[model samples]
Target: MTVRAAWLLPEGQTREDTRLAPVTPMAPESELRSRGGVIAGGDPLKATGAGLMQLRIGTGRAIVQGTDAQGAYPIAVTSPETLTVADGDPQHSRIDSVMLRIYDGLYDTSETTTATVEIVQGAAATTPVAPPLPPASLRLWDVTVPAGVSAGVGGLDWSNALADRRRYTTALGGIIPRGWGLAFDGAHDGQYRDDGAAGLQRWNSAAGAWLPYPYDSGWRPLALTAGYGNPGHGMPAAWRRLGSMVMLRGRIAPTKTGTTIANGATIATLPADIRPAGGKEFAWASPRDQTNKGPSVTRVEINVGGTLRIFESHDLPSWISLDGVTYCTD
Candidate 1:
């Protein structure tokens, strides 16, 4: 049914600054009786919520949804003005910042603050008269990747579908300070990527490896507790890593020789951080001969836990140099 035509202001809008638009009910003029500025709405001819209102918005138009003649209701903004938004001049303020977060089902969440552009209205690429973008460096262009929307509706503001803002921290979009950056406490494989100021490094949480770029600044060589649960000698195993490569060396005098030492005695334990990336075996060399003590030194294995095992040693006092390279982390 037809009701009194009046101006309606948008929600959250200030009463004074907000402008109300003229409206026309869908029913014919004679169907409903209008006196003064009020409308007497009824059934069959009025008061029904089936009627719509037509209004002119800019060079385009809009149709407002109907509601109870007594109660006010917002118009369902059906459709858009394809010719105006895509072909006419629109007003907007400059947005100084924007952020984008990408989430994969695997719990792999990452974000980028370097999003380089702001989306503005104007899609009339087919119009013979080309539309101009805002002056002074503002630009608009078509890209292969588009805002996620129905086909043919590219670059429409779909940012409302973005992830929750609370999930992201303030350190994003700023030159973050290390050691005090984020307080994740600790997480599985808690990875971090740093800028050149820290030398482009990442946390090798799985292996406990250090990071580097120019090398010297972020790396250090240290001594590992040589020997596993069994400590036979006071051997010191020194190790250092750069990138994925590891270098370790140590010397130990075995108490057992030959088959007696073949019990897989762990002579030196390396750090728990190195992984066997190169697949290279640990090598040992001794000056002892067949007549020395037990049997000649044979083979050894360096574990990721920094454990160095002497598979075969000859004499009780012969010194053997044990060394190997791995890409593992502790």
Candidate 2:
């Protein structure tokens, strides 16, 4: 399915009586000129070639059934010529949480004034159907904070503000709360391509460097998603895998010194031993790493000294074990 996001304006938001912008163009595709790039309004981005277009607002609602409560959505004025901003109109508006409705049971939500609608078409830049880059298998992590647990997972410290929508690159790390639980999907960033060896790269914050994730000291198979490649390990090695899923569970730490876990590990056992101490954040590592070989992992990650867990399996029929633990095959 295709997903799309937009900004919904109130009934009188565009009213002449109110100092708001009006739709300038009647054509379907509108033009917008921003500081960084140009956008065409109503020109929603397609994810797949034949997928249906769904709508979502800031991190809320999934487009299924009675999913989203009716509300206004914010949309980018694609065409400046089509949209007319009243002279000296207020730059921003603080309204209720944004919501979007696509079809019946297919939608997404956004927190910003507007929603980001990713239409599900055959294939577009927004929706590249080609196989995911390199590391095929991925692990999912669920972070939860328990009440009265003295510790709390620190918020993601995105170097840039949440408002800036650019290619964000930062060390991924956080704490797992002691009480409540939070679950989300995640994956490796890119293919494995180190200046020296064949393993994946690990961040060394103290030394300020990029060393290989210890995948067998000298061999590493680039992990894409889960269940796509032959599971194996070692450094200086590369395996072209597809994609898979992972689950993470733990308590939110009170501080930033996060926990580390290797990719391909079990998600259920995390909460017991990984709890934070003295307000330090949680750190995690993955058994997989991305290489210049294949698909690019985008969504989620965990970190610490940048050296979480490492893997070396090159090919395995089912989920295997490393560091003495069996993990689900991605």
Candidate 3:
């Protein structure tokens, strides 16, 4: 199923209406814009293919059955252009709540005006077919609490999503609560959450949150130049990355200080840790001398493709152990 999010002009709404933006864009995706990016009033982006009549919403009637109370659902929209929730599995219960973003940007809720609509699932009648994303599994929710009774687990003050929609301890029932997502304390509150380029995740969606699947978020360790320093006590070396920044650190033995390396020579070959993106060049901090020599020893580093160059002040001064830290671009 595909849903749509829009900034509809209310019957009397104005540009200065002080209302919240209609659709909260997801993080790391639609936030920053480059030279070629979304501008105000830009048409919706293409789904999987090129231009298609993707976004559509209009007046719809909420189903009514007998005197249980005729509830009228207002303006239901699902399956935005960015995603599509398709049917799955046979036993999978044919109904549940789907995640969505209502307000795109920060705005005053007090100033915004709109009627509430209860979110329903599987076209308002869960009968097993056309259920949103599935793998053929049955989920039985324990929504047996009697009405008009101060109760245990109610889905929410809003949302008619079934009990299994939350974090369910049994059979992935996922009995998650409303207003909780991605960061719930429990083990599972939601279902498979797509991390864009990262991959997919499983959660309870309601009572639980998205499961933790830490990606190689750019902090990988790189083995330093092996045995490049003093023989048995080669300079202890380690390097790590964080986003666009790379940190390199190492220590040299006391006796081998000023006499360890050749003048104006490369101390070690760089690991992939600090290789600039696309092999492009980036400015990095100059290397330092930490032999407690104060002004007696000075060191500098130069990037030669993927090599580290070192220069010393005196070239042949006996000194204590030394430790240094330097940074580079990722």
TM-score of each: 0.30, 0.15, 0.32
Which sequence of candidate numbers ranks them by lDDT, best first?
Answer: 3, 1, 2
Candidate that scores best on lDDT: 3
Which tens-of-lDDT digit does each residue in 80-138 have in candidate 2? 11111111112322111111222212233332322223211111222223222111111
Compute the lDDT for candidate 2: 0.23
Sort by TM-score, best first: what order?
3, 1, 2
Question: Pairing residues by index, what is the TM-score of model 2?
Answer: 0.15
| Each candidate: RMSD | 22.0, 25.4, 17.2
Superior candidate under TM-score, 1 versus 2: 1
Give the Cα lDDT of each candidate.
0.31, 0.23, 0.32
Candidate 1 residues 1-330, lDDT tens each? Answer: 011112332133333322221233322212231111111112111111111111111111111222224222112111221111121223321211111111112222223111112234334332322124321111212211222232244333423211111111111122112321233321223333334254544434554543444233223334433322212554344566665566665555534343233346656555544546333355445556556464455666765454566555554334445455334442
Off by over 4 Å in 3: 1-220, 229-236, 252-259, 272-295, 315-330
